[model samples]
Target: MRAGGFLIPVLLVLAGCKPEPEAPALALHPVPVQQRLPAQVSAPALESGRVSIRGDDALADVLSWTLPEASIEQPARARAAARRALAKGDLFETAESAIPLLLALRKAQPDNAQDARLLEKARAALLAQAWIALDAGEDLASLRYAQRHGTVLRTLWPALPEAKTYLDAVDRAGQAFELCVGGERALHAGNLDTSGGALELFRRAQALWPLQTRAQRGIAAVQAALLAGAQAQAAEGDFEGAYAELSRAGRVRSDAEAIATARQRIEATRTDRIRRLGDEGLMALADPAGLQIARERLAEILRIALPGSGAGVALRQRIDLVGHYGLFRPGQVFTDEMADGGRGPALSVLPRGGFSMGAPEDEEGASPDEQPQHPVRFERGFAMTRHEITVGQFRRFVTATGATPRATQRGHSLAYDARSGNFLRGSGIDWQSGYDGRPAGEDMPVIHVTARDAEAYAAWLSEQTGVHYRLPSEAEFEYALRAGGQTLYPWGVGAPPAGAGNLAGGKDVSTRGRSWSNAFPGYGDGWWGPAPVGRFAANAYGLYDMVGNVSEWVADCWHRGYRRAPSNGQAWVNPGCRTRMYRGSSWASAPAQARSAWRASGGVDATNARVGFRLVRQL
Candidate 1:
């Protein structure tokens, strides 16, 4: 039967005429058509015929066959299909195929009301899909879908509320998402300055997306960072900086407990700092040199705005006291009597004032070393003994401390020899021995003591009285000697008045058969060697034996002249200095040598009957 079917087609082709066109072939099941066809029917010819037939009528047949029961010819069925696609979240297919088809059906079938309703339903489904994209956080996709189909839907159904509503929702979602992203970025960067702006963004985000958690957490993180930064600033002692950070945090979330705690810590730290500064100022009151530092600290405390508090008031008062009266005022004299032996010197206060140290060049007997006289000032006042340290006081020091005088250790000292009329080193003479080789009286000024011995005695005195006792500076010694007088002698410009001081005179010739080669000639108090302490009348400043009796050791390294002397009455000490300056003159000194500005320098370790020292108490 298959052979007869092929032969009929061949016989028809064998006729010299074209055969009539038959219906296009289609299969409901797979068939071996290639094998069943005539050999003359080439594969290309078969394929061409199949394509032609599909173009003619198989297209509709294939679509009807592939589509599930719905046909484009039926508008209601097509609209239903689009709805199903939208429901399944197939936005692309709904926009590209279903929406266009529904629009065409609505245009063609205007009178059919059901077709118009189905068309409207399909457009609504597209609008819903756009909103769905928005809900899924696909901002670009949502915007794209809306832009693609929104215009058509709006034009077709002017009263469809969801068209406008969905678009508005998309805009709000976009803004909220943008704000949330910005806030999170700022929080992650730890930018406190920009954190406030970021928080504003988060707040706006919450306004848009009321149920969003990211915006809320972003705001909390920013506030926490600000509070933590404030705490760190407080720990570093920057209260103002901390307050600024805290204020920003407060703006973000005003009711946070951490903010309140940080504020409290800042207040407590400020108070403690003020208190510490007050204590430091009080401690500084003990020393005049520390007044500057105290003032600085107190000024800082005052700037912190501690109102009407006792601590602030006390600090101000203390600062004022220091400013007005200084740590120690001038003209305030006191005495320190030792508790153990009741053997300490009377002290007189000298204020911070200016003076011209050394004598004028034109002054009589003024040496070149005393030339170029310069001005000096004292910033801090000190208390000085009224008289030179006496043999009795030195003896007490030696007995208490067991300190041996340099001369005593050497077993001899510089003594004035009556036979030779010259100062000669004598055996068995020490501080206990007078310049004449006789035992010194208890009240006599200590002689034959080196500078080291004087320093040791001053040290012991300081330990005994719990005061700072030391030798006077050269300028200090001169200032005390002048006692506000401008004369050659503390008594006057001329030779010392009778009984004014124990100077070289007729008394020396009569007692020791030796006298100054050029003596005052008319002046003679009494003693030829060393006189008792305070035997001479006190100077204008109540200091005794300032110009005579014996030269006093001063705390200054010997300089060639007043070339580089201190403008202040402070000691010019040189480390390992071998020579020390001694002011005033000895009992055997000539009248010119006894002048106030007649200075002499000697070996620091040299022991002589002429050298002695007085003590000063630093206040």
Candidate 2:
């Protein structure tokens, strides 16, 4: 009888409850056609029976809603009978009930005071009945019962404040009904946990009318479906999918014991599957050639197992330790035994650590290509040759494989022309040539070798030493060049410490008495060309000649910048690339080129004196 317990005189208008004006003369003017508009709040889904005033229950019937034919056409007689019916507690339930009968009488004689009084009495009875239904329970059926009475009052007499209140309540019931029905349809369509699925629909319905039986059942049914789906998913060894389904179920009822029970079941199944996968991975790891298969198994276990699970973590560690060719420690100096009863190049096990790989924008000599610095980490210890590979190492590849390098096959290579202060193609120059186109010492870093030549030497060394060997990735080169130094320069933010390595210097003059126009001030290595390998001091990582050496080809394609660069120290390469990256500064490189992040590229088939490469072995 009130809007949220406060009398609201104008609430009916807000609810769209404007009734027709009462007639002043005692004559039955038929109800207007517009006033007989069909009711929007149909009660077809309610249990109170066919409840439209349109007088037809056919599915497609669209006739206007109206009161029953005026029974007892005599106004005075109808008024007395309605009073008797009201005293007997007969209300809107029956055609002859006091509310409907009196409404018809008032229509025939709109100014009859006695009939109007009697109708108000019947409305009071109707309100009492609706209150009883409202207080009956929060179940869907009881709510619908109350809505049925509200519908009757709103249609025939909507001026009362109570009609607006009950009208709003009935509208909510209609919404709840629609939502529950949609939930049922989604359940049948197998849309369990997706957006707008059964779970979402049912939970929304419950919110509108808490514990309304139909909505409650819809929620329970969705939860059950989710739990069953989780079990089936786990049975198929898809533990992640199972956990996903269980999580969906928990959203429906977080404290439901069934969720915890299903989670436990899924966990047991997942643990067993992870153990079985670990065993298979271990078996694969036992084979000398099964590392790839073991890696695949490790990937699967990580997907299903919780983070840091013992089985998953242990298997990963074992896989990483498989190819420990030297069993060396970080910063440990060691060499693998070669098949020829010799030894591989001296190597320093670079420590496993992280470093900012590219130059910061604030660094004076930093270029746009080095903007957006990114971090790189080495997860496993790797062995990098302490210095560039020498002419002697490459000579062994040429003789054993009969592989003629590009420079040799072409009968010439790029060599520094001292007289012109430029590099020009030279005759009869090859990997065995020096920076001056003369026969090079075996200890000098090999010159006039293409990237393919470097890679070929690595392959030959791998066969000889029975260990993996390849050109270091650009990230690895930069990491070693930095050598735990985050300064702008490899040797710190000043001139390269004297005799640091072979670098273009202000104090050094060429054989023709030419000095570097853009060289480090107050510094010179006293060499007009690349010095013999490791001629200078080792970096903090205990590797020699990293900051200043012949610029070396690394195993990466020439990408424009650090965008989408690899975070780990792996090579970011593109297959069949024509331009490959070279890192570290050469003896001819300027001070700007000596920054740890500086890099350059040459054609894959390009061979020159200023560029050489070193080998890195897997540990």
Candidate 3:
């Protein structure tokens, strides 16, 4: 007989043979030992019938896995007979031959209960083996073994703590086995979804056994094949394919390091390929001297416009903007301002290098109108209004230049209400409402202003201060918001764990509620009125109220879509019409409406309690 005749016959029998009639199952009874030892002793009775060398060879293969360096004695003649029986597919004879040794196990135990308990454990192990085999797609063999083992476990279930575990494992294995067979049929008949579902079950089964070398390798191989297909698609210029492949890889393996590596490689490959295809190109510096001059001018503007601001906060904002938009390097700043209802002598200055820009797509109230998103790119930088033009500040300008006030109230700011002629709160006034919504106050933001009024203020300030101040282009507003990173919010995505912003008033107004309406705590959702500006944590850029206080008016006029939008960081003002852009959001809006990318618009004259403005300058 060949060296592996015993194993070869067993394997061939298992491959095609049907199960035999069930016999009374034998139990495993452990030997009683006076002292603990590293290894277990075989039962003497079974040892006598073990066919010595043939049995030893068979047991050796199984034991080697658990104890790599082991030696055993074998009787050549007895081994030869055992090997011949195995070669002839005589499993019954082989199994019967081992029973003598098994009986000795029963004798070794002191009591019938102990013998019974050990036998139950042995039965459970067989059940577990059935389960493992089923998962490996060995349906017939696993089912036969499971039926045999399960019968023994059911009889002994009351005596074993592990009986339930073995039962459950067997059930899971049965389910997986069914799926695998069904999946093979589905694949043959071209039912991709059904086939895929079964494959997924197989993958899941493999994952459950972290230490199963065969299962682990099988999973990895399947995943690698899928990724390879995706890579091919990506190579053919299918960006969607590439993304899908990477996403699949992520599902297969959630290792952070692996995911990151794949991400980097994917990006590098795509970028290189895109460049080769000439789909995009880099901008070369046009004039070094002009760029330097712009830089210096921007620095000077920042020195004046952002004086006394915390360095940490401002620097952080700048870094965020640069990273998100890839618009400018860290520390760039640019300013634009609006004034006097579009009555300008507008001053434009370069905001110094490094400013945050752009909002993410998912912010509250963000709409499709805000997409086709990219970074803000300002060729030059300058100074911007530290605060929205205040009633007092505008009043000072009026006083300095002798410009007539729209409303001639001594202390009462002239605001028009639809019902009342002059309202104190600017309740119903358009953006052009005079007196800056307060009586000569230099610190209060100029309210009730239209886009035109904002532009007028910018022009007036430029003429008086010799510094060009203008409304920040839409791009500039985003840049300022980002400040220093690619965060979802000016602060960061998700609600800050600490209560910070003034929305419906909670850690996260959008996410805090039990339901949509219940999301915010302490405050009703957009049902309550608006609050004053600077009412929440300032973003890293030193800008306050970028979200949920009041929506700030932006330089861009309304366009339903981003088609033909400018890429130079300037406001897209061509064929511009009645509607104007607003960013951030207000108390009256839902949390979704307060996202960084959120946008709103109304007629040029439209004004609301939650509408406000900030100014920027370029030098």
The candidate scoring highest on lDDT is: 2
* Candidate 3 lDDT, 1-619, residue by residue in tens: 1111123322232233222222222222222112111145321111111111111223222222211111113333333443354344332212323222223344454364643553444444445553454344343344445534444455435345455454444444333333344433332232322236424644543433222233343334334444444555555556566667667656764456755765565555554453222111111011222333333433433432224543123222332233243343333444323343433322223344443344445545456776656645555454444445555556556666765433232222324233332234543233334322323223434555566666666557755544435576676676665555566555666653343455654322222232234234444423233334454566555566566655678878888766567665667653326788877655545656655666777677655445667776433
Models 1 onward score TM values of: 0.48, 0.50, 0.37
lDDT string, candidate 2, 366-389, tens digits? 887776799887666678999899
State the C-alpha lDDT per candidate: 0.66, 0.73, 0.45
Worst 10 residues of 2 by lDDT: 27-36
Q: What is the C-alpha lDDT profile of model 1 across 1-619, one tens digit per residue?
A: 0111122322232232211222233321121122111366421111111111111442233223221222357666666766566456443333335555555556667686776675566565677665555555423333334433433444445355665555444445444555665565554455433535667777876766554455666666666667666666665556677788889879876567867786887777777677556545544543567678778777777766446654456556665666554545566656787858695887777755667888888897788889788997765566789888888888998898888888889898888877877789999999898887789898888989988798888768866876557788888888888887666777776656677787887545545455567887666675777888988788766788887789999878889889888675667766458999999877878787877778889998898888888988755
Model 1 clash pairs are: none
Q: How far does residue 218 in candidate 3 sit from its true spot (Å)?
A: 90
Off by over 4 Å in 3: 1-366, 400-442, 496-499, 506-519, 522-536
